[model samples]
Target: MSSSDRLLLILHIGFAIFTLGPLTAATMATPRFIRNQNLVVVRYLNRTTRIYGIGTLGIFLFGLFLASGDFAKPWLSASMTLFIVALVLLLIVERDQRKAAHLLETAAAKAAPAASSTKTGGEGAEEGEKAEKAKAAKPAAPGADIAQVERGRIAAMSGVVALLWLVVLVLMVWNG
Candidate 1:
């Protein structure tokens, strides 16, 4: 195959991976911890958060390289346009994840009550402790649910991206 073809393949795979990796991570790892309130998993995703951004950057740069060049047939332009919009939607999805992550982190670090409380050796102290625990037990307001309606939007982005790839294939293999 030609160098351009090799590049296209790399770009296409990289872009798709970049777009879909967090989706998999969020969907898979999230459910594992959301119910249990696990910190390690959240930290794992947060500390390495740059992967999502860098992968997205890779997708934008590589996908544009593939699209702007006339490697594909002219009839595939509409498909390319869909791919572009799909990338945009993917970026928005990433932003929403970040927002959710931030909220989760905020909830986590403060999950326990402040340490300044006096646990004096008395029944009154026991009552105070129970009250504090009760107050802290209230569920935190999350920025977004992983299972929210926006997730549907994210899935639609993937579907559109797949559609674009199909269009490109059709234009190149069957129609060209």
Candidate 2:
């Protein structure tokens, strides 16, 4: 591999790990927590998408350089295909989460004025705000309703990616 190719591969691997790390971390959270409109999942997924998408794109670009020379093998092709698939899956999952997050935030914002206005504009205001926050703090209901469906798919996506990278590791070591 050329210096650029090797550099791209290293960068891509770093991106892959960063991309998948949120997935693993969010999965460790409860399903309701993962799907909640709290923005935690949204931020995590968005970051995951940006890093993984940009990183793998760089890899794909560099793959052109690699393929022009000594690295254009069948295994490399398969690995590339797998990598593309993984990126697509990650994007899909993150998109859904983003949609859900935006929707929920909007709803909460809408409810906020009404909720706050209801207070008597004194200690009641403080109490009402506290209550509203408490309401928000509680995890949103869990289901595959929106993002949950994509969240469910995350494991399969992660598993396939793990398998893909396993093949990559094997080929890299064995010169396949």
Candidate 3:
């Protein structure tokens, strides 16, 4: 290969590693954090998702630069299609993470008042019994249930993205 081709190939690989690796890690961590109701980690993962979203552009641009000479290759076309699909999956995962974070935040807010009231020892015995019964009578929060479902979706989608990346890597290495 020529020097320019070599440089582009190197940059493409570098961006792929830098962008996809952390993105996968963050995406994987997101569901766990959401399951734990750890909003802090969920928010951090969301930020990581955004950062890698920009990094994905670098991967795409560098990949296009490297593929310019062989744009007609079937493998390249397939890889491009897979990359686009993976990007869409990543965006969906990111959106789910944001939703999970919001849900956790709202759950925390709703619990705060009850926690503070209990800590202050302000309620009499009958009132305390009523409060406890009221809490028990409340249905499961929809946010928590939705967040759990979203986390499962994110995990499944992230796995598909990883598999797509693996296929792309194989195509590039063996068929490019």
Candidate 4:
């Protein structure tokens, strides 16, 4: 391999590790935080997913450079196709994260007013506590169930994206 190709290979590998790894982790962890109604962490992970998702483009670009426009190689073409599919999946996952976060925020906003209304100096303290317990035991509010579905979808899609990355990596190592 030429010096430039070697450099490109190193950069491709570096981006794959730095970007894809975090992207996978962020997507996987997002559903759990969304399920827990941790909006802050979910937003953070969403941002992380976006950043790393963009960073993954570097891996593709560098690999393309390393390939030197030799698109005839079956493994190279297959890896490229899989990588594109993974990017599409990640984009969908990102959108789902945003939707889940919005749902959580909406639920929290609706609950906040109800919670404040329940407060009546010290008079309704016991009643408020009981209400809170009952509320906890009650079925999820309208948007909450949708958020739960989003979380499940995010988890499943993220898993599929991660599997695509693994398949691409295997193609690189096994067929290259």
Candidate 5:
């Protein structure tokens, strides 16, 4: 391959690793954090998702540049299609994650009053203990079930996206 081709290939691979690596990590971690009801971790993962989502554009652009002369190749076409599919699926997963996070945040806000009231000296010690136990036993939120279901969906979609990425990688390495 020529120098320019080598450079483009390097850039394409670099962007792919830089963009997809964190994306996969964040995507996988999101559901786990959601299950734990750890909003802090969930929010951090969401931010990583957003940042990597934008970085994915570079992967596509560099890939196109590398494949500019090989557009007619069947493997290239298939890889491109898979890449698009994965991107769309990832976007859906990201949206659901954000929605789940919001639902959790709202639920926490709703429960905060009970927690604060329990902390105040106005409440008897026994009452405060009961309140704390009740709060712990209470469901995540009014929509906590819905959020859990959504997280499950996101996890499934993200798995498919990860599979598509692997397929695209295989195609590029073996057939491109």
Candidate 6:
């Protein structure tokens, strides 16, 4: 391999290791934070996923440079296809993360007033009894269920993306 190809290979590997590792970690961890209703951590993970996800494009670009227009190789083609699919899935994951965060935030906002009212103990005994019954019949907040559904989707999609990355890694090592 020439010096430029060597350099490209290094860059490609670097981006893969640095970006994919964190991206996978963030996506995997997001569901847990969402389940916990930790908005701050969820936002941080969302940012991490976005940044690292974009960084992964560097890996693809460098790999293309290393390929030097050799698009006919089966392994290269398959790897590229898998990478693209993974990217699409990651995009969906990103969207789901945003939605989950928004839902959780809204739930928190709505719950705050209800929480304050309950704490003040301003209601009559009958009213308090009725309120407690209503709270028991329902979840802590509206949209919490939807947020949980989003969490499940994010987890499943992140898993698939991680699997794709593993498959691509195997193809590169075995076929290169």
Question: Which candidate should be chosen as best, given TM-score against the real structure?
Answer: 4
User: What TM-score does candidate 6 get on C-alpha atoms?
Assistant: 0.86
Tens digits of per-residue lDDT, candidate 3, 111-136, equal 76764575334557567767667765
Tens digits of per-residue lDDT, candidate 6, 20-57, equal: 99999999999988977888999999999899999999
- TM-score for each model: 0.49, 0.63, 0.84, 0.89, 0.87, 0.86
**Tens digit per residue, CA lDDT, model 5, 1-176:** 99998998889899998889999989987887887777888888988998998899888888998887778988999999999988888888889888988988987887788677766465487788777887677554554564777789888998898899999999988986
User: What overall lDDT, based on C-alpha atoms, would model 1 receive against the true structure?
Assistant: 0.54
TM-score of model 2 relative to the true fold?
0.63
Top lDDT prediction, candidate number? 6
Model 3: ten consecutive residues of lowest lDDT: 137-146
lDDT of each: 0.54, 0.59, 0.84, 0.87, 0.85, 0.89
Comparing 2 and 3 on lDDT, the stronger one: 3
Checking candidate 2 for backbone clashes, the offending pairs are none
lDDT for 19 in candidate 5 is: 89
Model 5 ranges with Cα > 4 A deviation: 119-123, 126-146
Report the number of clashing residue pairs per model.
Answer: 0, 0, 0, 0, 0, 0
**Candidate 2: C-alpha RMSD after superposition:** 4.5
Considering TM-score, where higher is better, how would the candidates rank from best to worst? 4, 5, 6, 3, 2, 1
